[model samples]
Target: MSKIKDTSVNFENKKNLEETCAEIYAVNLISGQWILSICYYLKQGKLRFTELKNKIPNITERMLTLQLKKMEEDKLVSRTAYAEVPLRVEYELTPIGKGLLPILAQLEQWGKLHKSMSEGSAT
Candidate 1:
């Protein structure tokens, strides 16, 4: 059996590396296969279940549901339900989720740069 590293550390004066690994935590939280895609779509605005499904054509309903549930649990997305003749539900990013947009954008820029460099070198 493998061992897990102790992550707890006193944070009274300064930040602890293990205890304050926000980047690691962020990466793990959004590391799901469909998470970034889902966040990209939701970043535009609120979307219903069907709308979200249509936006991500290849994702199965089950997978989308699961990802959404996990994101909701992580406080990244908000699920709202309305009572009406036809019940309605919408999902939108919470404040924390919105804060991730800049990071995602930076990642996208980095990916583009890497891809360009890779292709140029391969030539």
Candidate 2:
């Protein structure tokens, strides 16, 4: 992901929109290609790093790490690291994150309907 400098105009606009719009602010919290997908899987149960990797085989390890870190910072996901011989770590959604499941389901429905309509119109 490209860095958005705090001093930049785009950053300013984003900040303003996020601050003023509740819906936009909510969207901003989970804005990324893999975030919602990760959340979908986590809704099932807590998963370790490799298990998540298996679930999303196409995503690079670096990208997964970055996205998980971002979610942790945003308080949408929680990471637990266990001190053991092999060193186990797991990721799961926070309660606030669990709250997004219904909204995500609605969004998925809307996306499918919109895509189908667009495709039908194009033919």
Candidate 3:
């Protein structure tokens, strides 16, 4: 067997890195309906709040506001505020958020496969 690192500092750093990654992943993107749906739409293109609301009709304004705020905090989404006559705002995925698309796609595919398998087994 290979020898392991004997330094406590090294071990603590490794643990901290893993914990940070886990925390980042567990920032609750999909916990709220509006957030996941918002990301789904943003993967296509940027959208205004009203457009997003139209896409997700069941989400409350308060919930959408809260989710967007959290996503912004997590750097998963960019919020652009314009200083126009009527003032317009739009939301889009940051590079970090865009990076999540492939993983999300794989998860979606797996979910479909799992559902099909479950139905087949039931039949």
Number of backbone collisions per candidate: 0, 0, 0
Off by over 4 Å in 2: none
Which residue pairs in candidate 2 have backbone atoms (N, alpha carbon, C) closer than 3 angstroms, thus clashing?
none
Taken over the whole model, the C-alpha lDDT of each candidate is 0.87, 0.94, 0.81
Q: Which scores greater on lDDT, model 2 or model 3?
A: 2
lDDT of 3 by residue, 8-122 (tens): 7866675666577875445444554566678888899799988998898998888788888889998899999999978899999999989878977987899999999999999
Model 1 C-alpha lDDT per residue in residues 39-58, reported as the tens digit of each score:
99999999999999999999
- TM-score of each model, paired residue for residue: 0.82, 0.94, 0.77
What would you estimate as the lDDT of candidate 1? 0.87
Return the top candidate by TM-score: 2
Q: Which sections of candidate 3 miss by over 4 Å?
A: 1-24, 27-29
User: Which digits, one per residue and each the tens of the lDDT, describe model 2 over residues 1-33?
Assistant: 777999999999999999999999999888888
* Residue 3 lDDT, candidate 2, scale 0-100: 76
| lDDT accuracy of residue 123 in candidate 3 | 83
Order of the predicted models by lDDT, top scorer first:
2, 1, 3
